[model samples]
Target: HSPYFNGANKSTEVDYVQVYKDVADLLEDNDYDDGSYGPVLVRLAWHASGTYDVDTKTGGSNSASMRFEPEALHGANNGLKVARDLLEPIKAKHPNISYGDLWTLAGVAAIQELGGPTIPWRPGRTDGTSAESCTPDGRLPDATKKQDHIRNIFYRMGFNDQEIVALTGAHALGRCHPDRSGFEGPWSEQPTLFSNEYFKVISEREWIKKELKNGGWQWVDKNNTDVMMLPAEISMFNDKEFRKYFELYAKDQDQFFKDFTNAFAKLTELGVPFKGDEKVYKFETLPVVVT
Candidate 1:
C-alpha cells in the first residue's frame, strides 16, 4: 500500500521486516543518552499515536500528521523534530512507506530491540497533506500532573487502569531530557534497556523531590541522584485505582511484558483500520555483544 495517495495507483511493496532490522541497528548510538536511540524512538512512536480522541476519532498515527506545520509546532510536541529528523534517512531509502507506518514501526523496533515486548503492526495508513490534518494540543500526558490528568488523557484513547499501568511501564526504557521535556533523568538505572525496572524502581525505591534551577519539581532516588520519577509515575502507585496492576506488574515482570504487548498493540491501532491481513512480528534484539 502507498503511504501517500496522490490520485494515482502508486502502491509499491518494500520488505519492511528488513526495514525493522535496519531501524534496530540505527537505535544503537554510544554517544547518545544511555548509548541508544531507544528512548527517543519510544517517544517518537508514542507522540505519533497518542493523539487519538474518542469523541471525534480524529487523531492517531494514520496520517503521520505531525509532519505538518501546526502539528509539528504544538507545545506538547516540543523537541519531537529530532526524532523525525533522525528517521529521515530510512524514509529516503524506502520512499513507499508512509511516515505513519515508518514512525510506528520504528517504535515497535525500539521496544523489541531495547528489551521490551512484541508489537503487532499492519500497514495501510495514508499520509495527510496539511496542518489541518494535525490534531489540537493537549492530547499527551503531562508528567507534572496527577492521576486525574493521566486518566483523562489515556481514557480518551480508551485505556483502562490496567492498560494504563501497562503502558506506563514504558517509562522503564526512557529518560526525560531537561531540554526536551523540561525534566531530567531516567526512570530506571539501565535507561537504554527496556524492562519492568520502572515498576520495580517506582514501587521499591524511595524518591525525594528536588527543584531544578528552573524551579520545576522532580523526584530523585534517595540512593541515586542520577535516577528520577515524575509526579505521574508516583501517582500510579499511590492511587488505589492504578496500583492493583502497577503492583502486579512490579511483582511479575513476565506479566508486565505480556500486558505491555497487548496494550501497546492496541495503542498503535487506535485510528488505523487495516485490511484483513496484517503482520505480527516478535523481533529478537541482537545480543549486546554482536560480532
Candidate 2:
C-alpha cells in the first residue's frame, strides 16, 4: 500500500500542491539541460495549450493531443516532441496526473527553476479524447511573418495586442532552431534564465542580417553573435504599438513578469471550463546556493 501507488488509485482527486511538488523535484534533479529546461518547458506548455480557439472551442491542453498523430504532424508542433519526451519520466512517476496538467506544471517547474515569477496553477483538467482535439494549422505564430501576421494569428486565439506582446516574452526562454522554426540562434546568450534580455537586446542592439548556414529566409546577427530574432519578433521593434509594450517590459522586469504570468496562465486555460476561484498562486522562489 505505497503512497505513490495509493496516489495513482485516486489520480483524479490528487492535490494540486502534491502534483506541483513532484514535478518541481524532478526538474531540480535533472541537470542535463543546456541553460535551463525551464524556458523550453515553458515553450512546451505554451505550444501544448495555445492551440485553443474559443470560437470553435476545438483545441487545448486538456487532450495532450500533441501525443496524437494529427497534432504531432503539425508544422508548428515540430521539435515539441523533445519537450514531451523530457516529461515522460515525471509522467511515469505520477500516473495519476493528466498530460494537460503535467505539461502546464512542467512550465511552472521551469519558471520556478530559472528564478522567474511563480505562475499560479490549478488542476482539474481531465484527459480528453482524440475526437475532442483539433486545432487548425497556422493557429500558432509563424516566426517568419511580420507584425500584422503576428497580430492575425494571435488575435484569432482570442489574445489582444497587450497579451500578444506579453506572450512573446516567452522568447526570453528558448531559441529559434534552424531545423525546427527555420530560424537560428538563442534569443539571448542565457536562453535558460528568465530575464527581460530579449526586449533589451532587441531594443538596444544593431542587427545586421547574414545568410543562414542551414538555408531558407533565415538571418544572423551582423556582429557574428549567437543571438537571433525572427521576422515576426523584429516587427515588434518596427511597429509602434508593439514596441510600446516591449519598451515597458524592458524597462521594468516586475511589470513584465506580472503581465507574462497572467498572459501565460490565461493561455493555458483558454478552452477549459472552471467554475472555481481564479486566484493566482505565486510559489516560493528557490534560493541560489553557490558552493
Candidate 3:
C-alpha cells in the first residue's frame, strides 16, 4: 500500500515533493519583478486559493479554475499571467500533476524559498476541468477598504481576527505594483523575502497618507515614500483587536511563523475535499533561498 496514490494504477511511486521543488527551481527571472518569480508565484497561489467560500464548499485551489475566462479576467487577478506562464513548463513536464496541485504547491515552494515557514500541503486537488467551476469575483480582500470590509471579506472565508492578522504577514513578501493593484511600493525593506517585518513596520513605521503616481491613496513610510501600506493593512492598527495580534507578530517572528503556517495551511485547503485521512507533506525549501 503505497502513499501518494494518484489513481494511476496505484503501483508506481512518484516523488511529488521533488517534482514540486524542480518546478520551483525555474521560478527565477532576471527581467521580472523583484528579480524572481517568487512574488508573483505567491500572488498566483493566493489568488487561486483565496476564493474559498465556507458556506458553500467551492471556489478554492481545488480546481485551478482561475485558468478559465472571467475568473482569469477578474479585476482582482490582473497581471497574474506571468506566474501561470512560469508554472506551465513544469506542468508540461509533469503531466500527471493537476493545475490545482501545481499552483498551490508552487505557492508553498515560493514561501519556503523566501524564508517563510515550511507549509504542510497535500496534493489531491484535481484539475478543474470545466469553466463552470470558476469562483465569482470579490472573494479576495479589497486594499482600499477599512476594518468592516476587511472583516467581511475574511470572515466569509471562515477566518477570525487572529488568523487574519497572521495571513496579512504575507504582505511582507510582495510589493504593490501600480499597474496591477493600482497601489504601489513594498510593505517591507526586503520585498522578496518572508518575515514578520510587515507587522513590525506596520507598528513602528511613521506613516502618512500619500497618493501614488497612479492617484491612489495608501499609507507610506515617512522615511521612504517608496514603501507603503494599504488601507487594509492600516486597519490592523485602527482596530483594537487586530492591533493586539499585530503587535505580537511584530515582536515575535517565531510565533508569527507558526500561526501563519497554521492559518495558511487552512487557507490553501479551503473548499478542498480530501479523503477522510490524507497525508500532508512539508516541502523542502528551494536552494535559491532569499533573505
**Which lDDT values do the candidates have, in the order given?**
0.85, 0.76, 0.85
TM-score to native of every candidate shown: 0.93, 0.88, 0.92
Candidate 3 lDDT over residue span 1-291, tens digit each: 555455556433346877767766776677777777787888888889889888987788999999999899998999999789878888777777788888888888888888899999987887778789998889998888898888888888899999999998998988888888999888988988899999888899899999667667899999988889998778767899999999999999999999999998888888887985766797777554457
Q: What is the lDDT of residue 139 in candidate 1?
A: 91
Lowest summed lDDT window (length 10), candidate 1:
2-11
Clashing pairs in 2: none
Model 2 C-alpha lDDT versus the unseen true structure: 0.76
Window of ten residues with lowest summed lDDT in model 2 = 27-36
Answer with 2 or 3, whichever has the higher TM-score: 3
Tell me which of candidates 1 and 2 scores higher on lDDT: 1
Candidate 3's C-alpha lDDT?
A: 0.85
Give me the runs in candidate 3 sitting further than 4 Å from their true place.
Answer: 1-14, 287-291
Q: TM-score of the candidate numbered 2?
A: 0.88
> Model 3: how far is 59 from its true place, Å?
1.0
